[model samples]
Target: MADAPPSSEKSFLRRLTVITQPVLTRIAHGSAPFITTFALIHLTAPVMANLGGTSLASQVMLLGREYYQTPFGEKYLVLAPLVIHPLSALLKRVLAPKPARRLSSILSVTGYTTAVIVALHFYTHRVAPTDPSPPIYAVGPSELDYEYVKFGLQTWPWRSWLGYLGFTAAVAWHASEGMAIIWNTWLRSYLGGPPGTKRSRTIGAFLGGVLPVATGMFFMWREPLMVFASHADRFRAAFSMSPFYWY
Candidate 1:
């Protein structure tokens, strides 16, 4: 007979489910897409900003800079979600006695950990305000005069490519896995079905396995991306203002 699950794992899962809903497995099914959607919306500001606004990452936030800063972004978006969503799921499964650990689980932990560290990094190593007087707000990275990106990519205090790759893997898996679950369970039901159809599983496999690998590889090859895009006339003309990013 198989050994039972660890007591701690059961307790953790129970507590987590209580904190979430009764359907612990389905929690990811719902929250993953919600979180990923919000996160994408939040980060898209930088891309939009690069296209439109004066270069400002602080503006990469939800509301404009009048109301909040590093503290708020770090807490609500990064820390709370880590606690509420991924960490709880991780503890529930990783601590279980059965089913030996897997690479997917390991990457999720690494990615979530990277998210926390990066959040804290932004809070602590915040860009200085362009103006230090009353009614002042902190400046964004692009707004600042520092060449930190080049420094990190080229010299000491290297950028966290490893952490970034982990983040990509984590994000890709969580987002795609959640999507796959919804597609498999919910959509298959719509078609009048039993579970575990080959097509549904095939879709799930693509989302869970293939997407993460592709995304991780992209981050790992980001410099090449920058280089390749650099030669494009449209991109070059648009981003010509930046010294480091001209590529």
Candidate 2:
């Protein structure tokens, strides 16, 4: 009798609820850590290298050495674990339940601890010093060596490598599991028209998670492999003159 309160009003309210639901869902899921991790990777990598021992140009050139020299950069090695480890821990918690919960929690603490230790190590040895001078080597002739291949090896010896190994492994696990969860949650609807129309979605998701992590593992393992192959000396020779060498 009152014109049914106008069908347009009812339709508008329905549309508003639908639009707001997803916004609230995203907020509830918490994207802060993800955004933070992305930001740290992009911003900190170059800055850390630049600030490692000298000016910005020196750091950028050092970063470029990875391409022609040994496929490793100071910023990459340092920031990767810092970013990936925590993200991995987060993903592990999100995707895996029972056993993963405990494991992820442990990794979260360990990752943060590693980062703190690394920061402290850098600050004490390199940053906090008043006189930051490059190292001089007395080999063959008194020449300035600007190769930094050995820089990676020197930073983490066998024991340090073991720590990095643990960190990398954790990252791999976390990334894989996280990918699985993302697929299940986001692409599940489009996976197939009907629910579980494609039963292989789980397997597909699992592989998606595993492959990228494996690539990361390959990078992580390269340093140790070079060390074990009696190539540490060569690396040292190559990296001894790195501009980033504060010690």
Candidate 3:
């Protein structure tokens, strides 16, 4: 009887170790973002919804929700990438034990936590699977738009707004930092082994200056971008209750 308990504990621990092995490996590498565009898109789109000027949130919300109405969402761009960024976060915490880089730790932690939170919110608050998401300019009662409205209403306060703004800023920083690392570590070598310091600083400066401008453009013009996009794909995306492709 005494040996049975110890044996059971060992068995349980052995299973745990087996399960955590892959996660630990990923965390050690933290290269999950390298394969998927989720790292950048997740940072940019959600932040715009949270911090971009007035109309920006609504546009982004519509695009995101309506994306599900189409069949493509379940594919690489929408759902797949959304799910990957956080799931791939396993490597850092499991293998590293301690965060090696402060910036990376912050980004990965916040990204993982927020991804779960957002998923939960969608699970709990999202409309029916058959529900059609309308565009931002839709009139009448919006069955598909309620979830995003709720999200925006919750963050209306100055305090909430500031917190989200800070988070978005951190996301931008983390993404830019990642790109910088890629440039320094990989791209530098490809450029015939150019001087590291000058090129790196130049690239960093360019990214720093352009992030805000790009964000502004994205925030203000999501509708136009999506309109252009939907034309190519034939997905009906609009603010009305009966959007283009509600299937």
| CA displacement after TM-score superposition, residue 88 of candidate 3 (Å) | 2.4
Query: Would you list the clashing residue pairs of candidate 3?
Result: 26-91, 27-91, 27-92, 135-238, 135-239, 236-244, 236-245
TM-score of each: 0.44, 0.32, 0.42
Across 1-247, the per-residue lDDT of candidate 3 in tens digits comes to 3445677877886677667755544442354453234434433444464375435544654565454435675455545655655554554345443544564454465555556545543442332223444333222223333233323333233432433344444444445544555555556777755434544544553465335534543344333332233322222232112211122
Considering every candidate listed, which one attains the maximal TM-score?
1
Q: What is the alpha-carbon lDDT of model 2 when measured against the actual structure? A: 0.39
* Local error of candidate 3 at residue 214 (angstroms): 13
Better of 1 and 2 by TM-score: 1
lDDT of 2 at 186: 70
Best to worst by TM-score, what's the order? 1, 3, 2
Q: After superposition, how far is residue 115 of candidate 2 from its true place, in Å?
A: 7.3
Q: Candidate 2 deviates by what RMSD? A: 14.2
Give candidate 2 regions above 4 Å deviation.
1-149, 152-156, 192-247
Write model 1 residue lDDT over 1-247, tens digit each, in one string: 9999999988887676565443545654545554665546544443343333322323444353322235775566544654557655665466444432465563355446645654543432342233333332333434331122212322222233343334444454445544545676668767755545445644664565445443433332333222222223222232222332333
- Give the per-residue lDDT of model 2 (tens digit) for 1-247: 4567678987886676566545543442344244334323422322333233223323444454443234353345444544554454444445332232354353345445545555543433233232223232222211111112123534544533443344334433333344445456676678834323233533443344334333433343343332333333444433344333334
